[model samples]
Structure formats: C-alpha cells, structure tokens
Target: MRRIITVEEHFDFPDSQTIPEQTEPENDAHVNPKGNDPALVTTLLANFDQKLAYMDQYGISLQVLSDPNAVASTITDKQKAVASAQRTNDHLAQKIAQYPGRFAGLAVLPLIDPEAAAEELHRSVTELGFKGALIGGVPFGHFLDEPQYLPIFEAAEKLEVPIYLHPGMPSKAQRELLYESPSYSDSLAGMLGSAGWGWHAEQGVQMIRLIAAGIFDRFPNLHLVSGHWGEMVPNFLERLDEFIGKIPTPLERKFSDYYRQNVFVTASGMFTKPQMQLAVTEMGADHVLWAEDFPFLRRKQQVTDFLEAADLTDKQKDQIAFQNSQKLFGLAK
Candidate 1:
C-alpha cells in the first residue's frame, strides 16, 4: 500500500491557556466548558503519543495538524487574539520539529488584524517552516474578500502557501435567519447549523463569495482547499458557472476554471465511493485529497475499507491518497 499523507487532521494548541476562550461548543460533548473529546482532534491538551499510535496503527505516514477551531477568530480583543495565534503557532512549530517526518503544521492567523495576519503568515512559512495557513471560514463572520483581508491574501500568494478553508459555526445573524427554529429544540438547531448540514453550506458560500469578489483574479497564485468534497461546491459548479457566465463579473475565467486551477477538495471523513467518484470526475484525481476528519468521525477502518473498495485505478488512488498532498505541500521536494 502507498503511504497515506493526510492534511485535515487536527490537534489542540498546547498553549491554549495563553489565548482567551473563544470557541463555543456545537456538540453535546462540549456542552460543559471543561469537557473534551479524547478522540485525537479536540483534546484540551494534545496527546502526541496517542496521535502517533493511531497513525501508526492506521498507516497514516503524515498528518498536517492545525487547531480544531479558529481560536483567534472569535476573540474580540486584538492583543489577546494576536497573542493566542502566536502562541498556538509556536507550539505547533515545536511539535512539527519534534516529529518532522510524522507531522506537519498549518499556522493559526490573527485574522482580525489582516496586516498582522499577513506578517504572521510570512513568519510561519519562512521562520517556522510551516506548510501553510488555515483560516476557519471567517473571523467574526466577515468574509475573506473584504478589503481589510486583501493583505493576507496577497501575503499568502507571495508566500506560495495553500489556505485550507475549514468550517466555523455561522454567525448569530446567519443562524437566526436560516438555521434557528421556534419549534425545534436547541440541539436540533445546533445540528442543523453545524456539522449535520449548515457548516458545509457556510463554507461553500464563503468560497463563492471569494470567487464573486474576484479574489482569485486579483491573487492568481492563491490556492484553496476545503474538506467534505469541497463542501458540495464541485457538484454545484455547473450551476454556479451558468450564473457567472451571465454576470458582468471581474473573474478572468469561469467559476469551474478557478476550481480546476486553484481549488483542491478533501474527503474529510466521508468515505463513500460515489462521493469520491463525483469529486474525481469534477476536480480530477490530483485535486482530490484523502482525509478522515478525525475525532469527529474517528473511524480509520471504515476509510480503509472504502478506499480498498473504490474503483479507481492504482495510479488514481495513489494520487488522492498521498502523492497529491506530497506535491502540493512540497513534502517530497
């Protein structure tokens, strides 16, 4: 079997205490402030040994780790946000140094201050030797294409690092408008707005906003990645392209062109063959990555079974499983 290199794996920041509390739990396990999931992803204190053991057991040769949530995104205090991001990133850099081959890191950015975020991104890539930066949807519900964030985009393009766009719970206004319910229970509302359905929808919308705002056109070298088969974007590309074709937009190419050139999608724990086939058909084998989503749906054997059962040729399977990440992240030079 080919070595598996997974990028969407997450680990909690070891120095989380330095940062102000930011993330609100979207699940029952986290309803208590002190509670944590032991499954490798959302631990309050990261357990490197357990993670390494799991990887060894499951044959994951490399996992690119990032903070489970946007720790800096919800913190309103600028100083605290910056401190949190810096501390978190430094901690991750240490972990990667400790296990350089087994683990890689994606920097946490203080997006509230875009200029500072740009500086931090450069530092992480140049100084810490990180693979890239991971931005969780938006900082405090603002989209990435806003002018304040242009510097961060420009910096990422200049730095040549991929931006892994992960999901954050929607803003209160957004939740109230689309996901809230007077009749349904709060648990149901949370489910609808988060992992069950709305989280991917929110991520898909954010990518669309970036496309519509011409961020891709402005930063031609910018690369983006999203999990869960691009949050349903690939399936809907034709419709999106139809609309873009009709608009008097600034995009230098059609919507699908951006996807083909700049976007990569990951499995992110959904290991069904049909979905993988659709992703490969739309994005090509090189643009699809393999992920387990970890802890949230921590079932490695299921993924193993699905991949073994998949109809893709050996070359295609090798590309999605490891080779694509190796090239995109420059893991093999």
Candidate 2:
C-alpha cells in the first residue's frame, strides 16, 4: 500500500472536555448522527494513542489535525475570538510537536479579526510548521468573499498554504428552510444541517460566492480546499459556466477557470468511486486530494479497500491518495 496522508481528520481541544459528551439517537447505531462511530468518537476525543495505532494498522503515514468544530468562528468579540484562536493554535502546535513526523496541522483562525488571523497564519506556517489553516464556514452570518475577510485570503496567498474550508453548523432558519422534512425529528434535522445535506450546499455556495465576488481575481494565488467532493460543485460545472457567461463580474476568467485553478477538492471520506471519477473529470486529477474525514466518517478499512479497488491507474491513485496532498501542502514522501 502507498503511504497515505489524510487532511480532514480531526481532534478536539482540551477545553472540549469540559463540555459533556453529546447523546446520540436512542436507536443503537453503528455511525452516530454526526457521521462518527460512538466508539471512534471516544478514540478521537481521547489522546493520540489510538490514532497512531489505527494509522499504523492502516498504512496512513501522516494526518493533518484540526478541531472537529471551531471556537473562533462562533465568537463575535474580537479580543475573545483572537485569544481563543491563539490558545487553540498554541495547543495544536504542541500536539504536532509530540509526533512531528506523523502529524502536521491546519490552524484555526479568528475570522472576527482578519489582521490577527493573518499574523497567526504566518506564525503557524513559518514558526509552528503548520501546513495551512482550516476555517469552518461563515462567521456571524458573513461569507468569506466579504471585503472584511480579504486579509485572510492575502495572508494565505503570501504564506503559500491552502485554507481548508470545513463546514460549520448552519443557522436555524437556514436549516429549517433547506432540510426540514416531514418524517425526520429535530435530531435528524440538526444532523442534516451539519453533515448530511446542508454542509455540501453551504460550502458549495460559499465557493460560488467567492468566484462571483471576484476574490480569485483579486487574490489570484490564494488556494482553498473543500471537502465532501467539492461540496457537489464539480457536478454543476457546466451550469456554473452557463450562468457565469450571463452575469457580469470583474473576474477575467470564467468561474470554472477560477475553480480549476484556485480550488482543490477532497474526497473527505466520501469514497464513492463514481464521485471521484466525476470530480477528476471536471476539476482534473491534480486538483483533488484524499482524506478519510477521520473519526466522523471513521471507516479506514473501507476507505483503503475502496481506493485499492478503484479503477484509476496506479499513478492516478497515488495522486488522489497522497501525491496531490504532498504537492499542495509540501509534505515529504
């Protein structure tokens, strides 16, 4: 098996321990509502021993760690948010130090303070050796393309690290509007809001908003990563192109060109071979990276087996599994 590097894997901060473990649905289930196995959540929330053991068993060489959910994105007060982010970044730096070779990290920035966030990004990449930052979507109902967030994009471009835009929990109105079905209860609705359906829609829209706002044209070197198969964006490439032609924008290139150049999508535990085929065809193989979405979509054996059985040639498979991530994040083989 080729050495694999999984980027979307998560671990919680020590502060999360103060919060009690969440109750899952009453029905005995294998994977919990958040797409985590209860047993794996225990392991994920615990120290790194189980993770290392699992990685050793599965041939995963490196894992880029970030929090399962972000603290800074939710906090509105700039001082509080920046303080929280610095603490988180410092904690993450220590974790990576414990097992530097087997681990790297993506820092969590205080979106409320883009200038501070940029400084932290520089410290994370240059001082702490973090690969990039992972942002949970939309802070204070504000999207990334908004002018206030320009510093974050500029910092990412300057630092040469991708911003992994992971999904955050959506607002109640947004959830109710999009995911309220007749049969499901509040729990299932909340699940859909986070992982099942809403995440893909939200992140995909966020990507489109950046393109429409011409953020790519303004910060041409900025790179962003979206998990869960480009939040289903590649599948809509033709339609996006069609719409881009109709709308006027400051961007010199079509939306698809910006997408193809500036965005990198990951499988992020959605290991379906067909989805991989579609993404590779639309976005190109080099723009796709592989991740297990660990602890949440915790199925390493299944993921490894699926990749091995995938129809792509060995080299292409390598690119999806590790080579592309290696190139993007500057990981060594």
Question: Model 1 over residues 1-333: C-alpha lDDT tens digits?
Answer: 677888888877645465455444233321221225543345523778778888888888888887757567557677877888888888888877887699888889987788888899999999998888888866666788788999988988898889899987776566667877899877777667777777789899888888888888898889988898899889999999997798687678898998888999999988877888899999999898888866556767665667766898989888988898988876762
RMSD of 1: 2.7
Clashing pairs in 1: none
Model 2, CA-based lDDT: 0.79
Q: Which ten residues in a row have the lowest lDDT in candidate 2?
A: 22-31
**Where is the poorest 10-residue window by lDDT in model 1?**
26-35
Taking all chains together, each candidate's TM-score versus the true structure is 0.91, 0.91
Candidate 2's TM-score reads: 0.91
| Regions more than 4 Å wrong, model 1 | 14-45
Highest TM-score: give the candidate number: 1
Q: State the lDDT of candidate 2 residue by residue for 1-333, as single tens digits.
A: 687888898887755522322321121122153443466576664478888888888888899888746566556677777777777778878877887689888988877788888888898899888899998766667888889889888989988899998876666678778767788777777667766777678888898898889988888888999999899889888898897789776779888899999999998888887898898898888888889887777776866788888888888888888899998998877
lDDT of each: 0.79, 0.79
